[model samples]
Target: MSQNREMKLAAYLVGTGIHVASWRHPSAKPNTSIDIEALQHLAQTAERGKFDLAFIADSLAINPESHPQILNRFDPVVLITALSAVTRKIGVGATASTTYSEPYILARQFASVDHISGGRAAWNVVTTADATGETALNFSRDKHWEHDHRYERAEEFIDVVQGLWDSWEDDAFTYNKQTGQFFNPDKLHELNFKGKYFSVKGPLNIARSKQGQPVIIQAGASLPGQRLAARTAEVVFVHWDNIKEAKHHYKKLKSQLKDFGRNEDELHILHGISPIIGETEEAAIQKYNDLQNLIDPYEALKFVSGYMGNVDFSKYSLDTPAREIEFPHVNSIQSNFNEMKKIVEKEDLKVGDLYTRFFGAARRDGFIGTPVQIADELEKWFTEKAADGFMIQFPLLPNDLEDFVRLVIPILQERKLFRLDYEGNTLREHLNLKKPKNVFIQKTGASKSYSKI
Candidate 1:
């Protein structure tokens, strides 16, 4: 069998902020998180480093239980769209929840971004699993949709979104100045889609994007989540703290794709990772320790407890073993909790030590070492089939990212493991993906029964 090519890389940014305490960092700017100029600089730096894409994560509702550190920021779609205007080459991707958004509106927004970015746009498809606060705020109801029901609605949502994207044919818009004709009316389509969850009518008002459609990315790890990804996602984001577990997940996800008649190469599995790079291993370790020391024990405990299914750790002693605590439920985010259990068990960590470990591992897999060492580890994961690539999350905003871009990226480029320059213009082109056909056009004028509109 032929081996896969070198892994691709992307940078993951969470709203207007990097570290939980990044705002407190002496050199950090308070307004950098939401400042357009700062974001433009960040995007340019990533492009200069030849990164594949700059990704922004989103959540519909805020967790009141969490800290109020760096959560305030701009909406992801609006922010990424603004970033697209400033950067020339970097792929601009953002998240939108299927549960909260209408398919027609989302299709227009994503396609608009793709056009504004000159074909460099992607949408991270997420089902809003926890929408209690959002429902209360938006719908005047506090109830959230059940897990299975959310996925079911998501299935229809995906269909509607894709159908809407296909509603406008490639040749639908032909501005013939001489005849004063703006569009070919015959080529226009109406998607009268009526599903169990939603009923959307008519063609999207926007033209087909430069890349035909924005790339679809998914990052759910539940059984239903994996199934959804196998069917619809082109890029799947994953998180695993251990190499062995990551490989297992990669193999399982790949195999599941085969069952759906999809090629393994069609889905790119990118693991989430954070690297603390230094001139030497000792320096990197020292930096890691320093960051760990900066964390507030009480805050770290609260974060970990929520991640572990909201188990209260307030009563537990600092030296209490994690294994002794009984968990009530293992729901959608079990993989994360399971990984925490493994770490605690492996290190024989007490509550305090585990809290510190959890703090270091939040939103990322920690990789602390010298520049060469970091590159070597990444190369191993790529070569060993552990991952196709990584979504890098920086612990501290520009500083951590600057270090990786300046130090480790060069090492990887020297080894010919990473791109020295971009190969294509659009996100699809950069990822070597073929433009998807407009499904509506394929079956148009077929039957009256099919043409409800």
Candidate 2:
């Protein structure tokens, strides 16, 4: 590996933690989900650790069985916007569904966040993960759009949003006070885009921000999802249980970059990892087991059932091996279903074990270790090309996150694998990603106004 190569990290900022039983943890403040101060502290903690970004994941629909974080939470964008104001450097990103969102409005919202945060903004584009069609009902649709169909619309949705983002060139916003003129008319261009899924006209109201444009982050691992990320994403999030699969997926995505007229350097592949760190390996094991023991079998089954294409695992004998049953066709989060299937076949996981197995990512035996050991695993992955960086989903908020920052981060920094101090001000700078040029100016040289009187 080149000495210049460095690991990028994003703190996955869920209120309690990523684990399904996190809310029940002894130290957990269950109401942290809606507590702005608590969230601000988390974001600040990530910033204090010099993380590249603080990310929040979202889903459109929720039920009685939904995880505590999902059941009651601030809208991700709005929460991030608030976090941005309190913190100065670490980037703030949130998930937004391309399926249910209007391109124009979503474009404006993120663009505004970029400006508000002085360009430390990212949009984690996702097609809604509503496997049960419950989200479709929320949107007044009788059925959820098919998987491929959602990605098809997503491709167009992203284009429209990007088009609107390019409405004004970097120099277009010239607020001349002495002169009557405000902004260069010639530099502003209207989108006037017409697509199979949407038709949007004219430029966005907001101008480009400090980083030129908000960073584009994506996390879909399906074929269509991969295609979308290859063509458009600057940062791609993925999850894998083992290094071999992670490396294979990493190489595959990087190779696809060329097919989209991009270079491997232009995009980053981030693997999602939830680390359970302790002063000693044994301490980590005990901590991991403590959280695992908190798992409510019923709630875990309910959540897993929804993810596994809404299969009602409750119908099966809890003692039944998952491999013995036939799973229905998954219409949502195909990558998740595919991964769960792999685990079911490889392990003798009974139906009762499926939920914890999936939610745990089997971390008790994997990333649960002392700081040096955890750092060693991270170094191995980064050096071996298994991942460009990691999206850390700490098992418990504040506590687990603080442990990683206080213990593991310094070791990685000492080895020159991670930055001791933030190298740049914006998210793009932190990741060493290039700020995208205004597409309108790139194609037309001089922007042509598309406004009609």
Candidate 3:
């Protein structure tokens, strides 16, 4: 496979790190979940490596039954907005749910971050789907919308957010002290959007950003989720752990672009990988084992059980042989349930295996050797079209993150598989993605509409 494109990399920093037991790892920094400085350092490390983005993910409510590491999290947007102050080049991605958030407010918040970061902002759009996750929050819904309806709402939700983003043109803000013309009214565009899920008034108060609007990132595996990602997501995150599955998903999503009149290049498909790096193969294996050993199997089971359609796996004997059984329709995340079913059926994994087999962040076969070996695997994935790049979730912070930048990134740079320096300041530019045209301005091709509002 030819490797012409430089692979894009984003730091997926969640919890203390991606691993369930990451915070408790001896090398793990304390209070990373709430520690502003810790998060900032991680972002800076990614920037030092010239990574494309730093993505923070969140679910609406804490799964009280979750492992201790995951129970506490800073709000993603607030955290990224803070990180934007410390890092200059890397994009800040904050996850917000379409199901629970008010579109207008969500739009303003992300737009604010975009301005704060000088256009290095991305919104990782998600629908809240934890069993009792929504109810546990402030919502009073006894029965949450089914998977299809949530996607339906999400589709409309994104449309409204994007529409709200178009409320101003790039040239709208003009402080003409000489003429006393405070602004170009003609350049301000109002988004009079009325949709099933939202009714946003004309024009967001924020001016057009360097990227025109915040980049949209989506992770959807369900049919509807896939469709939504194809239509609107600038970057699509996938849970694919194998090359063959990654290739299949990558091809399927790219295939959907033409239907939306979008170029395949317009959507970057990134597979999530948690890299456990070491100076040597032996060191890397030892580090990975140490991380996994930190996890309490019972706590891990509870964590996956919540996500696996709220099934009480603890009730089943630890050694209960996993079998192919049709799970009932789960409102939480049908796609995850489906994925787990396939894994169990294929591997014949048992309840006992959920700890490392399913819940652990460190994938043994992933970029798990010396820096050069890690780069080799990444290059193969990039060239093979298994991924446009990787959403890299480090196994531990400061140490693990520091090692990747210090070691693996240079190998990728030496091989010309990754960039050593950022050519453009904006996140979209860093990713070689086009800044989106304002929908309202695209239609009129003139600034007259700004004043007409």
Best by lDDT: 2
Candidate 3, position 253, lDDT: 89
Assess the local accuracy of residue 98 in candidate 3 as a C-alpha lDDT between 0 and 100: 86
TM-scores vs. true structure, each candidate: 0.91, 0.97, 0.94
lDDT of 2 by residue, 1-453 (tens): 897898989999888998888899889999898999999999999999899999999988887667778888999999999999999999999999998999999999999999999889999999987678889999889999999999999998888888888888888878899897799888888888887888888679989888988899998999999999999999999988789999999999899999878989888888888899878988988888898899877778888888787777778778988899888888888998999888889998888888667765344546789999989999999999999999999889889999988999999999999998987788899989888877776464865543211
Q: Comparing candidate 1 with candidate 3, which one achieves the higher lDDT?
A: 3
Estimate, for each residue in 134-216, the C-alpha lDDT of model 3 and write its tens digit: 45346766566677888998888888888778787777778899999978877776766666766667678888788888999
What lDDT does candidate 3 reach at residue 86? 95
> What's the lDDT for all of these models?
0.76, 0.87, 0.81
Candidate 2 vs 3: which has more lDDT: 2
Question: What's the lDDT for candidate 3?
Answer: 0.81
Write one digit per residue (lDDT tens) for candidate 1, span 1-453.
133365778887653344455555566676775788887788888888888789988765656445333356778899999889988888999999887888888999998999999999999998754322343356565566666777888888888888888777788789999999999887777888887877888688889888899999998887888899999888988977678989999999899988778888888888877778878878887766666666676566765665676667778887888778876554435456666766766777777766556543332343778888788889888888888888887766677788889998998888877878888899887777788877764455432212322
Q: Candidate 1's C-alpha lDDT?
A: 0.76
- Please report the candidate that would top TM-score against the real structure: 2
Better of 1 and 2 by TM-score: 2
The C-alpha stretches of model 3 lying farther than 4 A from their native spots are 1-4, 134-137, 324-326, 360-362, 447-453
Q: Candidate 3: minimum summed lDDT over ten consecutive residues — where?
A: 444-453
Better of 1 and 2 by lDDT: 2
